[model samples]
Target: MAGEITETGELYSPYVGLVYMFNLIVGTGALTMPKAFATAGWLVSLVLLVFLGFMSFVTTTFVMEAMAAANAQLRWKRMETHKEEDDDDDDSSTASDSDILTPDSYERAEKQPILSVQRRTSPNLFEITDRVEMGQMASMFFNKVGVNLFYFCIIIYLYGDLAIYASAVPFSLMQVTCSTTDNDSCGVETDAKYNDTDLCWGPLRRVDAYHIYLAIFTLLLGPFTFFDVQKTKYLQILTSLMRWIAFAIMIVLALVRIGKGHGEGHPPLADPSGLRNLLGVCVYSFMCQHSLPSLVTPVSSKRYLTRLVFLDYVLILAFYGLLSFTAIFCFRGDSLMDMYTLNFARCDVVGLAAVRLFLGLFPVFTISTNFPIIAVTLRNNWKTLFHREGGTYPWVVDRVVFPTITLVPPVLVAFCTHDLESLVGITGAYAGTGIQFVIPAFLVYHCRKDTQVTFGYGTVNKHRSPFHHTFWVGFVLLWAFSCFFFVTANIVLSETKL
Candidate 1:
């Protein structure tokens, strides 16, 4: 089956696409950022976040440029296929979906998409209308081993994202419902690192309550993986609205506390000890490269596409700075929670049951919506990876087994531990790095070479990145490796620090 395609005439305005991109990048990562900022020192966090955001933007362009090249190549083959089919009388012959256009695939030119798709594949390299997802591009440029590596990194990243959602929703539910009244419950004054053995309802331990909630979350969202789940336009709007309201409330409340001269944070200018976690958190917050094809393909206009993306990043950086800075200063550095919204549940910051209720359940509403979708995507990826052309699967294996595997590992992960910070940190440190920096860098570099070979050196790709140089590509790769080493060292040193 074809991947989700944003059709040509149904494209969104460039500005509208900005909102979607913004929404995509600023997800659960934002919720976990304030703690990292507070711990790392506001000044240090600010510089790191800004730099990371810029790096993510650089990679975003890299992915977009590669996408356009892919589109151009597809269009070229469609043109060639058009000529061959015209010369033959077999109008019923169709291209095999597995046939990807490359130097090797040239001999089997009959198995390429024909010019019937030309309207969707525009002549202007910048105005690529076909929905060439990242997976397709990886196959187009990379050899078998390279493609497998790409999928592995992506699968790991998706699992990390799912695990976060699985754990976060239950953890949030436990905190909110258990915090109020009921002495048998793990009540309001439980320690920051409350354990599973603590008192919950009746004979239930704190961990029992968390696991119970996780089970409930799994039952509710996990089954959606058995089928397909697409977030409708209405669902997107609602999620976006809730996000804006929750974030706006958080920033405003922090500013209010700061304005009253009640700010408690007095962080150092920089802390070498906290930089590693801070880097991971900031990298997670600025992520969007993986979802770029879905975001960029639908945009109707090409003019100022890069500028619009830069502006969106600027806005996001400002938002994160405003949110994290306000949070660090308004709340004491040491007192900040991993899930920042929980801090407002205190009597001092916010007293209204409505505000606390809304903020407290924010993750439940948002992450719940996303969990099943990611699960389904991972399940689909599994099928794609192991799939053979002209092969089929038993119904039980396709429907029951794939979803079961996808659902179990992450839920079991949440069952074992609910440390959102460690989950996000590890996820961002490794898979997140690959998605944001390494994959995009490699994809663009190899894509540039492929484009030249396929279209000849003289064919200028109009949509190539402004940072279209070998040095930029090398810089991105070096930076990715440096980050990998830093995170590895941090993990080892952290283990020793204990």
Candidate 2:
């Protein structure tokens, strides 16, 4: 199986792949968590985030197991077909020899060479050597409806990610540019209490300034979706560096403030109403299942894939706990901002002018690098979803329509509301729920069933989950539906009260 499928495109080491997975999972979702934590109360937020992280880890392993099974199935089928073709050629040559063959028939038989699978032993049924993307595996193992559902779920999740990126970058620009500190940092932010409705320069209100910034942002980045972009290794490194420095500063600053006996927030133990949004934010923060193939495939050694993933999740959980816990305790509940960095823009929060500038503009720099890449990703997904086996689209449909569809709806949503917490929460709870929870569960169940039927129950995949019991699949489904019901009921109840 290893020979048949060329899986040796090991471009990076296993540890590098682990870092890639960690970066992918810990993006914009982390930026929106502090506000949600303040709303839900610190104790409730901690419990919910820990549980959701565990749930997400479980589904992640399910995806890894399914990937292995898909590869094994591919290997077995290729070998079977090769054997049948060999048998056909040998039988045909024998039949011609038995009969009175013409010169033409003999020449044809001489030209034909027999390829025999008998020369090779049966493929290793447990070997996982190739990259099988989730969509391809879905089509391979799922019913028609399930395949369509998988695509739909993934598309919605990608749209949600794009929307978050779109809104966050512009909102950060608006905050940092308009609200400067009164030190070596900058001028006064007008009235310190003036809301997002305040004017920026002349007649342009902050909302209007946000719209202008959004327009400029769209013009700069949106066109990239129409064409293809290449590797962004340098961009990734810069953004990652900025991300770590900014987050570390915020956490350290908050802890120092608490030690000085100036902590203003004293949240209750738990708040049931806020739990709905907290669960969504945590699930969103832990999502990397959709991109698992690209992250896992290029590793030189995959034997320790599980260990690497487990360690990454543990670090991410600890980071989220520290960051949010510090934010909620350092600032008043009402003072927490949707974009966490805004909480530090004021000199009072962090007296250093340089630190305030860095923290305030962090989202603009980091999310800016990501926005174009995600736009292109969403555009490519559109092409794949509509692609036919032997057919092609016109240049206009291929370039314009797909990119437009990818770039517009999200920008429009962001324009309507730069409220990052609500945007992240809603998107996470619904589309994130499907991708992070329900889809992976269904994928593993179907992959396992297909493996049993094709390779018999005696065959065990090398990468099957540690919690490989059938019961885990059912539990994932049940928990996802329960969250869905609770979120829906909460939204309805809030609307009724309004």
The TM-scores, one per candidate, come to 0.90, 0.88
**Model 2: per-residue lDDT, tens digit, 112-223?**
4212211222345555567788888889888888887888888888888888888888888887777443463354341225577876767778888788899998899888
What number of backbone clashes does candidate 1 have, counting pairs of residues 3 or more apart or in separate chains? 1
Candidate 1 lDDT, 8-112, residue by residue in tens: 435778888898899999999998898888778878888889889999989999999999888877877785686566536544435763233333345433354
Question: Candidate 2: lDDT of 388?
Answer: 86
Off by over 4 Å in 2: 1-8, 84-124, 180-194
Q: What TM value does model 2 have?
A: 0.88
* Local accuracy by lDDT, each model: 0.81, 0.79
Error in Å for residue 347 of model 2? 1.2
